[model samples]
Target: MHLSIGEAPNGAEGGATTATRPRDAQGTNEPAEPGSPSQTIVTFADFGLDPSILKAVAELGYREPTPIQAQAIPVVMAGKDVMGAAQTGTGKTAGFALPIIHKLLPLASTSTSPARHPVRALIIAPTRELADQIHENVKAYSRHTPLRSAVVFGGVDMKPQTAALRGGVEILTATPGRLLDHVEQKSTNLSQVQILVLDEADRMLDMGFLPDIQRIINLLAAQRQSLMFSATFSPEIRKLARSFLKEPQLIEVARRNALADNVEQTVYRVDGDEAKRAAVASLIRDRALEQVIVFSNTKIGAGRLARQLQKEGLKAEAIHGDKSQQERLQTLEAFKQGEIKVLVATDVAARGLDIVELPAVINYDLPHSPEDYVHRIGRTGRAGASGMALSLMVDKDQRALADIEKLTQRKLTVEALAVTLPGRRGDSREFSADAYRGSGREKRGREGTAARRDSSPDRDRSPPARRSGSSPNRSPAKTDPFFSRPYEPAEDAGVEAAAEPAARNGLRRPARKVAALLGGKP
Candidate 1:
């Protein structure tokens, strides 16, 4: 479900309505508010929005307000507290930002005094990317107004953030940690804040930022209008909402935890760990996947596979926590600009990184949690565009796959792949699985060439022949003698532990993949 706030049409009294607007195929309103339960709506001018803000919205190519926008805009225009619930990828950022900008425009115009430089509106996000995203949206919505805005997050340096604050911004979008740091340094103030928005409230709770959030909330004035927006409203979110919002208006576009109907999802049942990578690569080549995002369980796996793809002459790059903010930003920019082709990323780099039209998102490794699976796939299929999500499953990943299917309440189409990506350390000759499973005579006919080797001519080669009396104590490593190395379980350890080398290399390493799910061919 998606939620938003906006103004009622001109001369229409301010009041809240729970009715929904009828949304079209693009999740847009047909001359009505998109995703709205009803066709009824209003214009920005009708809501008494500032000329500057209205002009900015129009310039952004937004014709009519979305459902959330149509319903919520009026209440917000009347200065009421709002609680919005919508799926991710909806225009929630502008839902609150537009009205807030309108309300603050007059205040900003008359209050040029240095004493009033303290922030008047605060937007808190769970991730740096989200914070940056909201900041960008605020800038666009408020472009025609004189309001100044800035973004602050933990991964980057503090000096510049401090400087930005000192320059006087009316609206501040930030991640909690850095925001607290600023408060501790006394470099910024929020005492006079009239509006506060907590975007992605569910994510903040999941991040264990409840304490920090509470602290920030306590510092704000009690008389302020509070708006909390999230993809889902859990019990915890409801409790927290009570403390911050006074008689808040609730808006939900979809039922909780539902995915968009537009996405086409599938799974591949790979038999062995060695085959997974090859299968993904084969899929990429066969499907001619372009601008695709391959998600891995660990940072190392993502990096190693990205580098291997590059070595194979495919453009690839990996992004994770280890990369410096500047490098991550640069790599993301390069990917966006089409300088690279395939992008391998961990879940941390996944959410809130919006690409205009991502086409495919591959689950190189399944997500740890079902909710995360939703978030990962959500990166694609945005804004009514069609998208595809493919999950590569080895034997052990069954449980994770099951959880995802159960949570989504849908069956995923599973198929076998012809090949997979090579393992991280070295490339292996592609082997065919079909030969061994064929009819007996056909298998025997191809055995000599496919098997290629035997323990002298006297040794039997059939499956039954090997099972009859073969020694069990022999090391499994001897089968591939040329580059034999004892198998270490740690090589495929947990996601964070595996990405150490990639973290060390950061963005300096050449050959990274740059794929987004919905854009262009891939």
Candidate 2:
């Protein structure tokens, strides 16, 4: 089905028809039709949420519940596991957080004792940035409630986190590695966890955290409620859900790998790699984007692009796996605070970033996976905000662009950006089909023959060497003068000849006359 922007492709309430919509703004669904689209517009009060939670929600100016939130909150509050798939920026965090906090309110301790809080709820995320973002959201939603929450992720000192856990906390949001560390050190306990939420489960799997997730699940109580949420649920994710969640109500607010309706995606065609960079700079400068995130395929590429942009006098910083946690956090903080105008990143920063009102997201290099393209652009156009996703495409990236289009189920409009830079090597050149076949060997053989002829002293005057059994008309073999045989003087040769063949045959004497005629002794 073709889904427009802001339209949910499937029923929000999993397979259930909206026969029973949540209460409306007036605290009643009296006039609305069953399963009417208006029935989905729910307020915080309609969910039978705690008074404290309602007050917090109102104070935060959240007038209406998002599609995922409206459908998911009730299911989670009813104590049923939920597997939710929605487009990014669809309020997935709050969908689970509100219900989790409301459920945990009663278990919160009234006393000031350190042992009062025993980690009743656990939320695991794939990245520290995402974990931190979720922690902030949970804290905001639970502002009026007595529930205490702590965030623990790598890249910072754990002393504060340990102290927070020991002092008592009702909710804990953490990345897998750091959470496992706490578990091993006995700094935190998961046995009392009544609810478990795995946010961005697919991303966790992509980051190779499946084993850690399995180990973490093994530590949780078997009787607890489990929630799995992701942008797209691949086969592996479905398998994981089957193993972890017990008959979860599958709620998909949008199609799998769907882009947000509000995000306008475009592909800018450039000539070559250098032109791609040039186009990025031009777009940012021309459009005057205040806050932008450019995605590269590799960490090194991200760093290099960031540096190159800086050389062009633009404020840009890169965050990737190679960077230390401190560096990444510092860069992120600076970007959020507007100290850095452009943030260049890899896919690592794609899922967890919650930048508000980000103007644009540029794809410096098209992601290998179409799912990643969704996540990358999902960084912007968040919370029903209008944003632009511009991809710098060259001829070589046609495959990636095609994959993205197929996955999104929509054709992206392509705009040609005028590239003045010289085209890359071989881009402007053409060759015959057999240009490279047997060419090098043939050229080398010809060069070797010419070199031998040029360097030989007699090659030009002498005939070519004849084989051993050649025709008899060929030139006779030249003799070597020095090593033919041992030879006697002329007088000795004459005397020997005369003695042996003088009587039998007429023998001619050698004429060594010059010395014999001049000497009396001769």
Candidate 3:
């Protein structure tokens, strides 16, 4: 059955329903549809959007409704739980935002202090940038309406967000962590939240925000209208949806967890870790990479790689959670304007970064989870334009690369970089300076899936396991569980996709450098 909104069980007295906004001087739902669709397709007019909101949509150049918006708006306008899975960049925000705005605009009529009224709608984003983007869109859409919106995220001082909260907002957009901080400090109240939206729920799940999300949910009234949007339907996210959504509508615009067809993915297998960097550099230098974002495993790695390339006279910069907010913004702006050739970053830069014409994304280090790999490559090939995503892999990263291949359900062409083996090469110096001092491996801890066991006969022929110092049950080296195992890259059924090098306007594109951080010659 197609994913559609379902009716609530009887005796559900506290649920929210889609209510029309208060009438204007003319008393109409046409907020401002100057050239709006004449009720032929599902337009803001058909969905009962406020005149102010319709005017905002017209001004924003959104003349048509996407498939998701067409299907979702009507159900959401009826005040039912909605679960939508449309592809990225598909204007999914308005599918729910416009309806929510219409339903809440009526509440403003009864408010004694319109300026200080508590927020009626809450939108949870996975990152500050996304939160800001959604707020911008919401503000633009509700410009003519009486709705006031505020965005809150970490990395900035809470004083400003706190002041905004005190000033009272009609719609609140925030990341989970900062939202919880506000709740803890009693700076914001969600007990009156009429509609709750979890945008990019998949990214939130990938970032391990489930607990924080559940905590936020506990503070809200269970009678509120809930909407969830995710790029993929993993088992965990599905479970979360089941617990929260009461017979919710399920909307999937395309296949689940698959990369866009416009994206060209490739994997380059090198002999050693050193070769990985060389391959990346060769691609930039030889291929003439004009604009690129390289994904590294750690903040230190990202910085070091950027600096290393920069010292080699390639323009590059590193950005992560450690960087000051201003620095991060500056780096992002520079990249967007083509001032830098490469922007090296961790997963913080992975999700929700929308660069219209970004040509390439290099996975300097593959992510362990399949979900992360999808997000990392998702930065490019946006807006239905063709783009390239190249991943560098060595012996150690085989498992991670394999996981990525499985997740995408596609096989990446393994291109080997031509390495000139030198006779009697000097012992490789450790690059673990201050700039390189951090573990690239994410700590799975005891929460992740159990470890895999080594069943090879060579293990039985080798030395016995050593006893642990702390307890008799523990081994000196962590033992793989008998059943649960580390990801096996060899056994994966790789996906099928084209890996040809791309050219724009008959130009052989090469990777460009953005910044340097290793404090050494590139």
Candidate 4:
């Protein structure tokens, strides 16, 4: 059974997050007063970490431990295997990184000799963004100590990563594929890795990284402490645990697929594709979401949504697998800097984003995997701040909605949303996404389709206008009905008349009898 601990309060990342603002216990980053709701029972020092590590934590202004941190630090310090299942944005990174850093301090060295530092702890994440994020957290916690950390992922040249690996790092963070690539090149050594962390293991399975994970594990020390973290403990996740972890401690700060109650979720049922885009635009326009991430199910959908929002005069950008790694980083930086108001992204490509205190999230297309629903909304209402989650649902999304409800164990009410678009005549048409409301798109589509079918087989639906640089009287080619008429036998008038008969049909040249051609000059 999943652990039944109550929902984790926001803004407190004992070990959960690397980026901590003055967040109150409820997880919001707002400053705290004497009587503020935030409460702390233990400080980072209580964990008996190295003085330098505590000093670094103090520099970041973290006092209390998040639930995961409170439960995980001691377990990790004890060198016990752990199976941690928590909701997204619950500070899972800090939960594992800190304790691992403390554990590695006894083996840490100040000497710059390449032999002094070895890959002691290895963290495997599902995506490049996530791998980089975990690496950053490790670096932050180990800053005051002699522990060195580095990250390697795909979508970039390997030379730099190869150099870092060769330079020797105590802690290594990498995505499964890139880690394997480095292993193949013999640039990274995993034989001495004592602590193995599979952060977001479920995502790895979802990404089909099981074989890669197994291969990497085979290269690691057999007796090492294994830690597996995921949002849920699906059957597949459980099987993975059985294969790797040896009687690991189970830690769940939130229930399976649990959502942050701090986030307000609203589902809007819309009409057609155009209406969906308009609904997203209207939501952003009407709600004035200064910084929001809109999630799409496909890379093309993400690009299209971002472009459509841009045409609507909204500052938007798209980030997905198709984009080059540099472009993705630039777009993400712009979004984080508030230069881009909307960041449309597909599921896996966006797996690495960690925005602090983001106010809202919008689902342009409901994800086919229900688990992703929880992950997408978890981006907002983070650090205990109240946030909004809005989803635009269409007729075909009913089953997906049902699956989500079944997964999250909550009944989501579908509401009508009015989306307005500029009409063809400089007017505005406001309509609801509810089908029973009879959106104008249905009527217009039926009429337009019938009109096209009834008129010439190939005719323009656009207004009838002359091309600017074409013939003024230019028209479609046509045929004469007379040419298609059936042949009729006329009475033979006279031999001369027949001999010099006027050109018939489309023939203009005269015809001679077969025998006349026998003459040499005929």
Top candidate, metric lDDT: 4
lDDT (C-alpha) at residue 148 in model 1: 86
Q: Give the residue spans of candidate 4 off by over 4 A.
A: 1-41, 424-428, 437-473, 477-522
Instruction: Tell me the tens digit of each residue's lDDT in model 1 across 1-522.
Output: 111122111111122334334344454444434433334454556556787887887877677665567666766766778888754555667778888888887667535554656699999998776788789888888887778899999988899999889878899999999999999998889898899999888888987999999999999999999999887678999999998899887765555446666778888765454466666677777778778888987978888788767877788898887888787778777777777778889876755666656778899888888877877777667666788888887657889988988988877877655663343236444444443344645644454343333213444333344565779665665442323555566756644454555578784357576667657543
Clashes per model (N, Cα, C within 3 A): 56, 1, 30, 14
Range of the 10 consecutive residues with the lowest summed lDDT in candidate 1: 2-11
User: RMSD to native for every prediction?
Assistant: 17.4, 18.8, 22.4, 9.4
Rank candidates by lDDT, best first: 4, 2, 1, 3
Candidate 2 CA-lDDT value: 0.76
* Model 2 Cα lDDT, one tens digit per residue, 115-233: 88888889999988788878888888888877889999988888988888888898999999999999988899898899999988988998999999999999999999999898778
- Where in model 3 is the C-alpha error above 4 Å? 1-46, 109-116, 419-522
Q: Candidate 4 lDDT, tens digit per residue, 1-522?
A: 111112243423333321222334464443323432233325667667778878877777676666777666767877888888765556667778888988888898889887789999999999877787678777877888888899998999999999999989999999999999999999988999999999888889988999999999999988899999987789999999999999887776654566777888999987566678888998887888898999999889888888889999999999998998889888877887888999998888778677776889999999999989988987888666799999998778989999999998998867998777556557666655554456666775664454344333354256567668888666768865445556555744443344343345445565565655666553
C-alpha root-mean-square deviation, candidate 2:
18.8
What local distance difference test score does each model get?
0.72, 0.76, 0.69, 0.78
Clashing pairs in 2: 5-261
lDDT of 1 at 69: 73
The candidate that achieves the highest TM-score relative to the unseen native structure: 4
